[model samples]
Target chain A: MSELTGYLRTDGRKGIRNVVAVAYLVECAHHVAREIAWPHRDRAHVIGFPGCFPNAYAQQMMERLCTHPNVGAVLLVSLGCESFNRYALEKVIRDSGRPVKSLVIQRDGGTRATIRDGQAWIESTVAALAEAPRVPMDVSELVVGTVCGGSDGTSGLSGNPAAGRAFDRLVEAGAACIFEETGELIGCEEIMAARARTPELGDELRAAVAKAARYYATLGYGSFAAGNADGGLTTIEEKSLGAYAKSGASQIAGLIKPGDLPPRGGLYLMDVVPDGEVRFGFPNISDNAEIVEMMASGAHLSLFVTGRGSVVGSALAPVIKIAANPHMYERLAEDMDVNAGRIITGAASLDEVGEEIYRLVLDVAAGAETRSEALGHAEFILTYKSFEPIGPACLPA
Target chain B: MTTTDTRLLLLSDADNVLVARATIEAGETIVVSGTPITLPARVIMGHKLARRTIPAGTPVHKYGAPIGTATEDIAVGEHVHLHNLKSNYTATHSLDAARAGAEGQEP
Candidate 1:
């Protein structure tokens, strides 16, 4: 019923943009990978892990990311000495029916030769991707992720709930929406559990938040940052309540991990906190990391709500920045897409901003570039982490 | 300016503190429920101001939920932040103090 069209992939998923992902297998290959994608930076992006040590979770994340619907092709740049299984990752991309190539700096006559060869592949692949089929797409087929960063007191009051309003509209229209950060959801778990579709799912939701609370307790830090206090936010629970507003009022359909896709259109919670004994230093290193995780789970776009202001965008998906502070909004006008801060100034109501977000989502899906996308903000990040499979209670059959 | 111009926003009905929609100056008078109250100090935008007298160790409410407990007695219209409030579950850290002093917000 929507006027949107998308690039059709072999996996039956549609992509808003056919991005060429130039992935480096480890830190050693980062420079070469960056150079190869620099000429076609608008269409190609660099992403990868820095660790030489292999982790099953990192491998799985890379596989999901390479095969993500938005990615039309992938180039694996390996230093050859790292333990990352570049061949396996390359095969996964090839099997997914996208063009795949690999270059080893150690074997391909070092930096200059590897870059020269990698750029040629990218140049040709970019030409081929322009011809990828465009099929009709709908809101129901779109997956959106919402996250709040650099939040202040105004975040919950204005921007977050506005985004939540948009999420409500999207979910009502049968679109899949994901809201994450279980650590931030600490104070709101019972309320979140009450909205679960099933009693068993409610238990899972509670357990996940419980795990986050314990995890942070062991880490000797809450998710609360120093900037948060500088902006008048005193505690983590207060921040959780504000962040929880982004989930909207839809019934919780399921709980998912970083790379897990929602079975159908509804709202799902991504358990971002790492399972086990804090093997990974933090659940997500920064805002960009969580955005990457959302893209790995098939999110076509993300709504980033910021009061203190964040300018970062994702490599594969577009980010729509919603400014929560009016003063900060004026200071960073070019970086903002939605001025939710207007709600506080009495220029716009909460629902108006919400409706505005709804329209913007549809407009963006129709190939309109977000401010970040227009400003050349294809920022990316990935770190080591692990996840156990989701239990039956997490997703209702 | 019009009286409709909100200098402070009460997020939830059960909230005990009102968030400053704009930076309110020290000694500025703000009408709350038709009673004009004078602020003793400035409240920055996105910061909290006490709606009523709050005793030591009472939960401070925002968005109708307990954000943390008050560290000391807080009077009406006073700024409520890390100096006076702390999380019940975990301690908040800031630049100055090692435990429960400042941060904008994070999740």
Candidate 2:
């Protein structure tokens, strides 16, 4: 493998993309922050929490996102009265050796003045980040995440397994690969548990999925969507089985929650379901929420597999969309990066497509713009949630 | 037109349903497990089709696991979709209704 160059952070982490994040503390400030990012869409991205009330999970997630390796600087836009701790978030970013500035609308005059000030700050940050030193990074330094959205029957047969194949190769090459959505993995818990590195970890895996099952049962809904059924997926378990294919064949290293970085490079399962009673509505309200959590765990880039077709990108990291159904790929060719549907059509084998996805990862890491990035799909979202810290066994020894 | 040998994918030997890699028209002949059967209805690409006779209330296997229970008897080559099958976990809301709700019909 060739050496890849990335922006070197003072904390010894490397960023594949040095992005200037414009974050709004509440929904009130979202418009101004978004206006600031609209012109410099390629260099700056908008990310924030919409709630006026305080949420520890949201705060922790924002802190992690601001300090994410991909982020070189942060511009916080606060409406001046929201409960989010802007001071603490700024301190965390500054502690990571990245430039951070917070603009409060109430204190800074109004919307027009705040937008102008935020835009000016964003420009300078981008310019300064352009001068940041670039250092050679290894595959082991890369944290990659995989997720499936708009899934169909073909997702498991093609896109997901192809992503799994790529994940297996990346894991073998000593890269950290993460797969998430415990609620979606309910039916395949037994099979997935068997792939855990140790028996205790396997038990943890089963228990996590069991908790997800119970939580969803209480809500009277599965993560399974109406579109999932329209695309020939019958049940949540079937979707879980399909979603499970993205883990590849490697022994799962450990399980981690959102914002918990993997100890070392290998396959890790992200337990996204909270620890207590069903509190946060549905864990992940949407696909972007899942992507945000993965980014919180330090994923440099994400591989998003879709059969019904999804066109979503992240604020901190880039997303590579892999199309599973040949028909959907035909319809949404401009949005997809990899056409895993060829595996089903016999035009390409799984290994061939898998290698294509793997090479694309390296290429994207090397500064190639994903289709979503080029088209400017920097979608971000954070919501209310609660979680008890993960147990020690969750991380590999 | 492609034959079933190229257009249908059997995920595993244990799977009782085959995924349609491409759209298969009604009356099209499909071979599964060395037996040739004519499709009873058009199966859309990415959808499932019964590879063997599945009686009503029997678990329908795809990817080698039960995806759902058949609501009615499904013959070989019959399309297995929402009409004849349902999720074992929860009642699936219709896409049209969900879309309507999403577009401010409920709020």
Candidate 3:
């Protein structure tokens, strides 16, 4: 399958959209960042971390995001005195050959003055980005990620498995499809491992689930929350079985932590848990954080499956929502892209909805705006965490 | 001697039990390994029931793996839920108890 033409970046990467970013360095800088993006709307989008505390993980995440494929330029809105490493972060973006500017509210006259300067920079950046070169894209060059949130009883039977169908088709088409949150794959570890391409890779898959189990056990909870329980899931492992179906039946290509790119086009698992210890409050504070990590790993688009419903989209990627429950689908029809619930009600088959999702992925990659993106749901969040490097066995050879 | 009715789904040959696709009623006749017997209770769709008579605390198998253990003796077609089965590591509740707890709690 040939991909549609995409915007070619100065660094030789291709993007479906050219977006200008406004990032808040701390909670204090959030309001200014929001105000700056509020007027531009489509052209300028807001993304940021709020913790005043310095985190290597946060610093790394910021660097990856500012240089992501969809980002044409960056405007860093800092409180000027926050502990974040803004200088180094901005340098990373500039080094990628993208336009970047930093506004330290403390250094600039004040909020009113900085907003004025930020708007001027954004307006010019938008103009220059309009002139950025366009080039033909290859289907194999795409990185797609999938996630399921707000799951109800029907998620596994419909939305998740339908996402699995789309994932399988995407991988067959040579797109690097990623499914993550190892913590949610706890009970399905054995089955997941058996699907790995090689026996060694199989062991690595099992170990990742074990790590998630231990990590969550220490916290006295599984990746499951109160909402999941309210939605008819009885135990952690039951939730695991349903969540794991989104991975599809593809062979595991490799395991990558946040900020590590997949080696090639295949299915990969993003280990959202930190490499060691339980110091971080939780692996991810919300679904958006997981989406951000997927973007950092080079996902050009995301397939978000929801049962209870979430209307979140990424700043640099299009999010296609597959509604899991028919009731929820009826309520959020305009907000969602596909209703996998039709499979449960007998209106459609899993393969049909899956094909619908697969078609939507291509349609979005070809430049259609997702409902979330159209409604201005550019939600982003990052936080403090620590990690050691993955061992040699973590990835397939 | 006449033949009896049975439904089988081998997800994989290695699997010990196959999942029930539709509800099976109590006292309904089923034949496994050429032996005909009546069901103990109604087995709901998507829920696992024993392929054989599994003793108490034996791991209940599904998807070719152990999902949980039988809390009480589970016969073929018995409703396998909180009363007769529980999650291996955590707790599970039957819809009845869950609904009762819901009704008992005042808003």
Q: Pick the candidate with the highest DockQ.
A: 1
Better of 1 and 2 by lDDT: 1
Predicted candidate 3 versus true structure: per-residue lDDT over A92-173, tens digit per residue: 9888888889999989988999999999888888889888876889877788998888775557667888899989998998
- Residue-wise C-alpha lDDT for candidate 1, range A10-89, written one tens digit per residue: 88999988989999999999999999999999899888989999998889889999988889999999999999988889
Give the TM-score of candidate 2 (chain A): 0.99
Clashing pairs in 2: none
Q: Stretches of candidate 2 above 4 Å error?
A: B1-5, B32-36, B96-107
Candidate 2 vs candidate 3: the lDDT winner is: 2
Q: Give per-residue lDDT, candidate 2, residue B12.
A: 80
Candidate 3, CAPRI quality class derived from DockQ: incorrect
| Worst 10-residue lDDT window, candidate 3 chain A | A225-234
What are the per-residue Cα lDDT tens digits for candidate 2 across A1-397?
8668898887677899998999999999999999988878798999999999999999999999999999988999999999999999999999898888899999999999998998888888788888888889998889999999999878998999999999999999899999999999988888888998888899989999999988888888899877787777777888888999999999999999999998889999999998787786888989999999999999999999999899898888999999998888888999999999898788999999999999999999999999999988999988998888887767758
Candidates ranked, most accurate by TM-score first: 1, 2, 3
Please list the residue runs of candidate 3 whose C-alpha ends up more than 4 Å from where it truly belongs after superposition. B1-56, B61-64, B70-86, B89-107
Show the colliding residue pairs in model 3.
none
Model 1 lDDT at residue B2:
21
lDDT ranking of the models:
1, 2, 3
lDDT, residue B78, model 1: 72
lDDT of 1: 0.89
lDDT of 2 at A79: 96
lDDT of 3 by residue, B22-104 (tens): 44566887664355667665543334445566789777665455656777786654444446655655444234544665421
